[model samples]
Target: MLVNPHICPAETTVILHICPVEMLVNPPTALAEMSVSPLICPVKTSVSRLIALAEMSVTRHIWPVETLATRWSTVTPVQQRRSSTLAPVQQRRRSTLAPVQQRRRSTLAPVQQRHRSTFSPVQQRRRSALAPVHQRPCSTLAPVQQRC
Candidate 1:
């Protein structure tokens, strides 16, 4: 194969080979190849162009169409049913928890106020700094000594 000296230096050579059918199908692959590697590697322009074109043709047209039908069909009815049913159970659990959550909220406000008044400001700051965000620290910071 004659390597275009302007494109590929004499010291190294690169070759690409492609069938005629691939050239007709995708042209961008060939363009990409010319842009990407011809300067760095010593490849014949025609061959790289053809190879790139062929790759593009396969990627652009052939593979996706071949996959489109099969990929979607692979999801079984059982899996679909499971996913649909699973979503609502999570929603229902949240709805069910709402009333119990409201009850807890009503009871907790007065108790939290009682706690604030009972502890001094320094102790309140110390307790808050040590406490987990979700749970209050009892004045003594011990579960056994905890007040309601």
Candidate 2:
């Protein structure tokens, strides 16, 4: 990959054309606080006409379709939007949470659900069955079961 010496003299560079913060901001800004300050990160790759892009910054930000889908994939959305101008300027919790979510599971969901085992009538079986496993069974397990 050809690195641009003009942008920054580094192999990887992040050009932060940050908007003037409307909200009072300090370091370590949380997602909740970001609602006031619409921080968007727009990426430009392989664009030949760099000069025109400056004038067209308004149109680029006016459409979030470019970065919305990508941001959705990574962040645990606080309140997901179908349409928004500043799509990249979302309240991102974390994009890396995807792996953690996948690692967790879809297992225990139906487990805790009320079990009206074929034996019982609908009303009578409203009670959840004796849990096959406790909530966070690993924590409760004896030392032997917890072995690495």
Candidate 3:
């Protein structure tokens, strides 16, 4: 447990029995208060010393935030390089696809118009076939089941 001497000077010597993992996961809200004051960790009271003690408590647990920050820093350059390499390829694909998409749209327009004109009769026929089944009395099922 990280105890800021400035915040709780009397209990500064008192060691907290909380697990570092628990502390990290649900960090004491007081840490935010301690962090608010930049001058809280002056030469007389060392924040590094408190942090070192906290680090010792959680020696087994990896400091995820720090680790991830470092990892992100390393990864950012690679990501930037990859994105830079991909930009031209993406632009080229977009350029090539634009004409193809326009051509497809033009072809599909007449087909869609033809389909709309021809589809009504087929749709009506289907609806008419289903209409009789839907309109049939439920009592007819018994006779059909008996025959089956």
Best by lDDT: 3
Question: Candidate 1, which segments miss by more than 4 Å at Cα?
Answer: 1-74, 120-148
TM-score of 2: 0.15
lDDT per residue, candidate 3, 1-148, as tens digits?
2445566644533544434445677676556756756556574368777788888878646676446644463657756676678779989999999999999999999999999989999999999999998787777777766476
Q: Which stretches of candidate 2 lie over 4 Å from their true place?
A: 1-95, 110-148
lDDT of 3 at 122: 97
How well does candidate 3 match the true structure, expressed as C-alpha RMSD?
Answer: 18.6
Candidate 1 vs candidate 2: the lDDT winner is: 1
lDDT of each: 0.71, 0.51, 0.71
Scored against the true structure, residue 37 in model 2 reaches a CA lDDT of 51
Q: All candidates' TM-scores?
A: 0.29, 0.15, 0.30
By TM-score: ranked, best first: 3, 1, 2
Clashes of 2: 1
Shift of residue 8 alpha carbon in model 1, Å = 63
Residue pairs with backbone atoms closer than 3 Å in model 3 (clashes): none
lDDT for each residue of candidate 1 in 1-148, tens digit (9 for 90 to 100): 3546677654444323434346556767866776778665656777799899999998889778655634564666765676677779989999999999999999999999998788878797888886665475456466665653
Steric clashes per prediction: 4, 1, 0
Q: Residue 63 lDDT in model 2?
A: 67
